[model samples]
Target: MTIAVSTIIRPSRILTALVSAVAIMVASIGLAILAGRIGTLGLTPRVLTGFGALFLAFFGFYHGVRIRKILQLDIAGAGQIRLSEQREKRTCSDSDWPHVGKDMQVMQLMPGSTIWPCMLLLRLRAEDHAVRVVPILPDSVSRESFRALAVAVRWLAWQSDSQESSYL
Candidate 1:
């Protein structure tokens, strides 16, 4: 029997806030560490910290904007997964030759992939060797669809692990 789950993922405000918060925290820590060493760099602590703060603010904003892409994901049975961006126009300078609006047969689920009740981090590798990391949050999809996707992804991961172990 084959279980297929398809879902359209929207941008989540929760994720944006989370990413921004993390970026801010890291930036603060980095600035604190750099504060002690600014004397050797021949720059005043106030000037260095001010520039660093501005740079981190821009960095956080950029990443928050970058995560707002709409996507369509399909998990077919226990063996196939496809992902495509559903953007109205190309936003980045990079070519969208293979995956944008097209199905990509994922060859592997790379490391650092995790499934949590509130979020799912899918690090997928396509047949062409391109890798994409997809972050899915509960607010990104309908409640029922989110539940179904989580179940399907967990089942797929389990099935893949079992099959690999059987071959070894």
Candidate 2:
């Protein structure tokens, strides 16, 4: 058995929102700077740009801190994993997977071994193929969980194969 822990895949909603907010901020700042240089632009443009920049800064700070807090939770670490078995649902499909849990960041579970702190780019062995349980958390999960999840996943895959073969 190769029991392991698994986390959710990357490109999470929180991350998407963060990126979009950042992009808007960048655009607003750029526009503000350009308008200031042109000197012909009205005060309204400057005011609106300044407001946008302010909102971006406020929201960015708020979201960043919130994400950090979520990352600190254990459930968040488990939530980050996306297993091959639950690929269709796209996020922690097995609500009852042993020791498996999820939050805004990580995916937690036990199969055969533990896989923890699995990065969004991290790839681990699955039951039938190699799958990447990308880290959706802004902060990385615990190293221990990451390793455990990997082992458990591999073990589960092995067990599944054996069962299928036996049935045949």
Candidate 3:
């Protein structure tokens, strides 16, 4: 029998902290490099430093806002998957799945999706052929739910591969 799994993804403090730490490190190295090349680039120190500060502020704001979305993901036993973001929910199946909302569109699991013990990187493709990447960290969900999700994802990937091979 196919496995059905549902997970509610909360905002992950760990992920946020990690991102912030990385951004800080990157900004430090970037400023260092800019400082070293300031004379060669023919730009004044103040102007170059201003540009660097602006870039760092923009980067921090962008990522800070992007990581706050709460997600609800469901995978049915029949290989149907649903993803809900805020009040908008979309479902996709192996074949033609009907639309669930006015703005809802089909989304399928794409290749290169990775599931690790601590994280899951889901690559999803929409009906409009746009790809979206979702990251799930351990702190985002319960331990039991995390383990179940990993197993379910692996099974779904295996099922998809076998089905594709059979068509050949």
Which pairs clash in model 3? none
Model 1: worst 10 consecutive residues (lDDT sum): 89-98
Give the candidates in order of TM-score, highest first: 3, 1, 2
lDDT of 2 at 87: 24
Model 2, residue 88: distance off in Å is 34
Candidate 1 to truth, TM = 0.72
Q: TM-score of every model?
A: 0.72, 0.35, 0.75
Error of 1 at 115 (Å): 0.6
Question: lDDT tens string, model 3, 46-110?
Answer: 45674676588568857776868877677777767667674544333435433234544345888
> Residues 1-168, candidate 1, lDDT per residue (tens digit)?
555666778888898887788777766655754665334454576556756775887788787877688887777665577787775633322243234343445556665689999899888998889888888888888898788888887887887788889999
Off by over 4 Å in 3: 33-57, 87-106
**CA RMSD per model (angstroms):** 6.8, 11.6, 5.6
Which whole-number lDDT from 0 to 100 does residue 33 have in model 3? 56
